[model samples]
Target: MHLISQLCFLLCAAALGNAVVLRPRDPVKYQLKTPPLDTPWTDKVGRSPWPQYPRPQLRRDVWNSLNGIWTYQAAAGAGDVEKSPPLLPYAEEVLIPSCIEGGISGLQKWGVTHMWFGTYFEIPQEWNSNERILLNFEAVDYEATVFVNNVRLGRNTGGYFRFTFDITDQVKRGQLNSLKVFVFDPTDDQSIPQGKQTKRLSHIFYTPCSGIWQTVWLESVPKNHITSVDISGGMDGQLNITVHSNTRQPTQVKVEIHGLESEYATQRWGFESDQLAKISVPGVKLWSPDSPKLYNITVKMGDDLVQTYTGFRTIKSEVVNGVRRPILNGKFLFQFGPLDQGYWPDGIHLPPTHEAMVWDLELIKGLGMNMVRKHIKIEPDLFYEACDRLGLLVIQDMVSMRVHTNARPSDAEQAEFERQLEIMVNEHKSYPSIVTWVIYNEGWGQRTDYFPEFKIVDRIRVLDPSRLIDAVTGWEDHGTGDFLDNHHYADPQCGTPYYSRLSSPYDQSRIGFQGEFGGLGHRPEDKHLWPVEGAVRTINETYEIHANTDSYNWRAHVLLDLLKQQIERYACSGAVYTQTTDVEGEVNGLVTYDRRFVRVDTQQWRTDIQALYSAAAGRA
Candidate 1:
């Protein structure tokens, strides 16, 4: 088998004349002058930066990861003028995927609003046989312009989502190819989905991150190939698969499902164009927080072969006894977990490594939590994959825009917001773990007059009907969406009553959820701290909990007591705690920012959290 694999690699290399040049590892070196909050994976980042394949769902064997040292220079203006060509002996070297503000990127300067990144890559000669060579960017903040061999490909706006371009015509066949990318992020200036990023970092908002913050890569695909595949599991032991292709010719989609007990069961379906293909599994294994069972699937269409996986599960808001409870796979499972901000101490928006991302999810699962509200930030696809595999529910929030004025947004801004919302749903709709989509969080950029919150909910429902929708979390209950979500802090006694008074009449159809609550700030022990430059000395100072307060004990006790109170008094179906981990100045996390310490007693916290399941089940 090893010999056969070697022979196959040799043949592929031979077919691609630039065998040695097309190596995965880049020769350029980068050293972080000032490391920021170093994790176990931080040191290994130089050689193998996010070595894992960027796209997990659509896996292809032949692809190159363009995530290593890249030549970078801080440019003037908002990238309005083309200062230089794609050719470069750049001013400085920075790590790809990590933004300039991050210490791991080597250029930790914050003033850089516009920058140029240049790198050279060798395209395998064999890849030329394919009609198109795709250059993919997992994410680039604000706006990004791509130049292939000094020839402009295109520009992509919106920082959070992924974008791709075809560079087949501009690339050199076997020689090294030059790739240049110019990025401009007007953090708070533009009404984009900036999440919680701001120039003046204080309170909830953290330091602004500019340029590319996710993986960049290249892939070669045939003229007629599978573009994307949307997979959703059914309650009736059937899988609904939609194969979207860029081909005009008739193609046959071959699907092979592999499970623990079931062997590779093959099925074929013929389609003239992009079509829906259904494959039934007699006894499908349902995925849950207890048992995360994923069915590996291999899809083949002509020369294109893609590897993917999907878990069988269904989510709905059903009345259990009198209260509307969230039903996961025919069970009224009260989703209780932390509001995960998805911010990393080392990499900010991006994780130090794939393992680091998985570790956070593992901790969430270990804490006996079944769900996580991904608070106001869109994470990489891998984050959702980890949740799916670990059997944790995710309430994916749409990155919010910075609303400065009371006036309604311009038409252009509203259009852009809708476009991003559509893209978010389309890109991540397949993830079974994403049980609910939280459209608006505490009315951050919500305007009911021009762009009604209800309209956005309607649009999201049209795009993805499989998952539940929280139209507006916290304050404004627009009388839309599947849940009446609210945010509260520390004192559950006063908070629950305030929530009740603010709440509209009970709608039996829609469930009630405390989307954000229990922000009991706890400062980690001194030894586990990796304090940033402007970070607060203690969380108590921010939350005004008094300097002498035993914060750790208070935080833990408050969380436990609130969890019980919310379940019993409010009769709430679900709740999301303030956060999973500390972020910058905001030290109200269950764990520290460096991920070195858990402030609360994990064994006891787990037991307390698990008690909610029993409590909720008894209510049903």
Candidate 2:
């Protein structure tokens, strides 16, 4: 009776306008994450575990695959309430490691969050007992309330970084156990890290992806597991590694260095050294797209062993002979690459397979570019691992949780923003590939900087000061990070070499990153399309009345040529072309949405890219 009265009162308050029921209003657009596995028109193999690599960038030989169908259904409400009635058949299914809003899940429509997914599986008995059970979630947008069996386990909110929760208490080996997840995303509601997603898909933005769109799996690790790893290569050219564990245990962890071992000297000490280890490789070749080189690393903690990899590299900017430019390995170098959406038709933001992730990086390198401004999103560690292994430089962006503002910080939103920012930096500080941190995203829904952009810059300095920080990209520059940034479209442009409009009291120690410039209008068409609609807004000029060439003109070749002209026109620190591939409504890509065809000739594009880079470096 007490509960019933409270429920009634809550409904009354909702009717009075304090709450919203969130009726299922149709989205103006929908992104198709997974199409039919067996497309009637293609030679693609339809297989479970679409992305096969456990770590796309960081390859490992021993790992289990956990991508396949998990019994799923949309609940009317409270899908797993202890006393709630069972959910109806749903007649629908969602693929594991895929978002509910995605086509790959077999449930293309949206609006509900109570998704019940169940799978029966077993782990070797040996994996339990002495070892701990860790459930790793690559990403689950907004909110992921997890359950093991009928017990409520735990929950996580961040959508970009990797998270692990111990389930040893609830999980049983060689037995059938149920795993349930509930997700809620108020996309662009100023509550979550909903970058550029809108309910009303118009202009350049498109629909939002709700539930899980990344890998979900389980791994067994010994009680004395390496919880975190921090990697860095200093001026001495020695690779440094610091490993943190769950328990001190005074464990003698064995270290295996892949490259020239003599160059690096290793000493093992328990919690005392914080268990720090260093290795040197003389004549070490730094990671660069043109001369891609990588090294491997394996660590053994107690009786447990884990294999991973890292690179030894450094990036900085300074005035050289009266010119400012980015430097790598003591040479005035130019950084050029793409704005990788990191999304795919098969997986939306989630790559279809591990191979899929590798393909994007490899292709970027093949294009003769070295850096990728990983635009407004954080990727799984494996993505960073890949960048580290394949010798790619990345400017990582912290996930934005609130709109930015110039007003004083009165709202908790600022605190929340800083909270997530710190978490991101803490988790990813170890990677050698990441060199910069991008704070506010496009001024999207900015309110107030939790810490002013510059203050936050100082905070990052205290946290992991080795890299640079760009407080805000393209606008509201508070002189943070180490670069001047600008955004242009369909053409080339550069900030003033000495003092950009945003740079006041700017030091020459840092230069500018073309950051964003070039919406080259190229379409690879069919294979790599985000969706046919975004690609064919108005086909051939005769499809619809809105198809006027002057207004709705997005024909293929015209866009590609425009991109070519833009790339040739601009000279900046490094040019991040509009993008690596097409996203939902943004058909400007070197490749189509489906990850198939290269709209531009690979060799020609590479030559042009290298030439422009050479020219830019010369000027710098």
Candidate 3:
């Protein structure tokens, strides 16, 4: 059988005009370099970049953060299951939660496919009360397999979702316990949902981040604790609460509602079953950009307790004045914000600090924008939490892959992509800030063959009926879903005609949305700009800085005014600007890549934005 397999491999190679199989060569050793650029928080990143509790939705006071320095070894091949975990007195150290390729990690090395991360932690004496100790990773790039004291916990795939393991049995009570993680990230070399990451960075695609890129921590909970929480049905007076527990045994759960507004009193309700229950808010305060009201919820099941917050709001597409538009809280409020690509010069996918994350959202709110399109990348839950708290509506994009648009993915790849997509929706649907789900972007990895019959968008709707779904962000629109979307660059345009690349024409039945527009890049100052060595520079509408008129700001206002006129001419609901910040090589940003400077006049732009919204309201 071995000989036959070898013969088949040779025959296939010959057919493909390629050489036969050979032994693998030793992996290349790339020199690591420190990044030149830095954010405002870089100097203050300190020992722990992310010290906050990883999971804000499910809060617990009894927890320990495992986010500091860790030793890591890198290799350039697919991980082997037969190989044992590396025994370490490792020479190199990387800051936990930052990708190895990131400068904030202290080692900016690339081309690493297989990586091993090792650290140590001690279990507190207070956490030994018949509780299950859970080891949680906020996110790991591509694939990760965790181990404790050489005992393998399990494996988790997907780069942008949180994964956890119950490590009660593996951890010691008082003494130190060793933790090891094996990570595999092939970047564009493999067929996976990688968003805008590419090994060979060019144009829109930027540097690829491998290994852990978010927070890691530990939490203690009861054996029968609540595993998941789903908060929905905010449209009506009642809010739906679904609690998923570890055990299937019948148990009673108590829910306490604390209103953020002082006018309402705390309400308590008891449920006979842990699965699902509907609780009524005494004063149903509809959450909107104008009035963002949040309610704190506490769930208690015997010894297990968890806290989370939700807002009462509803999102839908309805016809107003003969044009379909986004109706938030049953009102016609035009949504407009930046196309936020949550990348940092220092941390890559992960921001330098939580304050850095909030800074972008705060800037958007301060600019008088009501919504932001999180372009083709899933941010950590804290980002969504900030949006929720700051009253900015979100249009979340699913990560795109490197798959060919004309062909179908392998059965396994298709299943995995859908699985990650489902997980993204399931995990983040509870956030009231997220009102729309963008399933595809510009046909990046979209499968055109699987169209009308494609149940992926339908599945997302079933998973989350509360949010509007963008079936395809820019192209290959199936004429289904909630919005008719298009992408225009350098300048703004409406989604009425479906653009040139889209498969179908505009559907008046759906809401018209300009997915992307108005890049309007300004040349960065020498000290503030990212080093342009091997970076690919694509020329757009770039302007020079002028002190008198501020040509950059003037250009931005002109384009925004044009956008307003186009929205009125085309009768579109809203639009997303090119981006919030300039990514690597993509200079079209309202803010620079390093978060150092703003290209536009903030106060003037805020006034213009208010005028845009006022124009939209005048039509209504």
Candidate 3's C-alpha runs over 4 A off are 1-33, 79-81, 260-264, 403-408, 452-454, 495-504, 536-549
For residue 457, give model 1's deviation from the true position in Å: 1.4
For 1-620, candidate 2 gives per-residue lDDT tens digits of 25653454345334333342332321122223445221222223233655555444233333455566655655555435443222211233456666565566556656665555544455656554666777777777767777665457777876665677888888666665556666656665445665655555553554556677677777777777766666676556676667667785456666655664455543332332245566554665566544545656666767666666556566676676565666676676666778876765545566656667788889887777778878777766678877876667888876655343333334565666777788888888767778778887666545544336777788888887667677776666655567766655444344433334442333344564556655545434344445446335622221122222233234323433443443334324555677787666565566656665565566656766666655655554
For all predicted structures, in order, the TM-scores are 0.90, 0.79, 0.91
Residues 1-620, candidate 3: write the lDDT tens digits.
25663565455345434445432321122222357678888767777668887777889888989998787777445645447665542347778888788888878888888888877678888775688999999899989999886689999999999999999998767666778888989887777999988887666788888888988999988888887889875757688888888886668988888863567677788885456687767676887887788888898887888899888998888888888888887877889999999988888998888999999999889889999999888898889888988999999998987843445566677777888899999999999989999877877776666663148778987788898998887777777788888777656657455456444466888888888877766667756667766553442323322333377678778878877786666777888887799887777777888888887788889988887787788767
The C-alpha stretches of model 1 lying farther than 4 A from their native spots are 1-29, 79-86, 126-131, 248-250, 263-273, 404-408, 493-508, 525-534, 537-541, 544-551
Give the TM-score (vs. native) of candidate 1: 0.90
Q: For model 1, what is the error of residue 391's alpha carbon versus the real structure, in angstroms, after optimal superposition?
A: 0.7
Model 1 weakest lDDT span, ten residues long: 18-27
Q: lDDT by residue for model 1 over 1-620, one digit each (tens)?
A: 25653454355334434232222323234677454566666665664588878778999988989988888877777644365452353567788888788777877778678888987788877665656789999999979999887778889988888998888888878766778898888988778888898887666888777888999999988878888888898676678888878764557777777763535254444543376666677667788888888888888888788999888888888887777778888988888889898887667778878888888888888889998889888888888888888889999989888855465557788778888988999999999899998777777777766437778888888777788998888766768888877666654422233445444544556787777767766555654454665566434444534232255555666666666776776557888877788787777777778887776677777878877787777777
In angstroms, give how far residue 279 of model 1 lies from its true place.
Answer: 3.7
If the candidates were sorted by their lDDT against the true structure, best first, what order would they fall in?
3, 1, 2
The CA lDDT at 562 in model 2 is: 40
**Could you report the Cα RMSD, in angstroms, for every candidate shown?**
6.3, 8.9, 9.1
Best by TM-score: 3
lDDT against the true structure, each candidate: 0.76, 0.60, 0.79
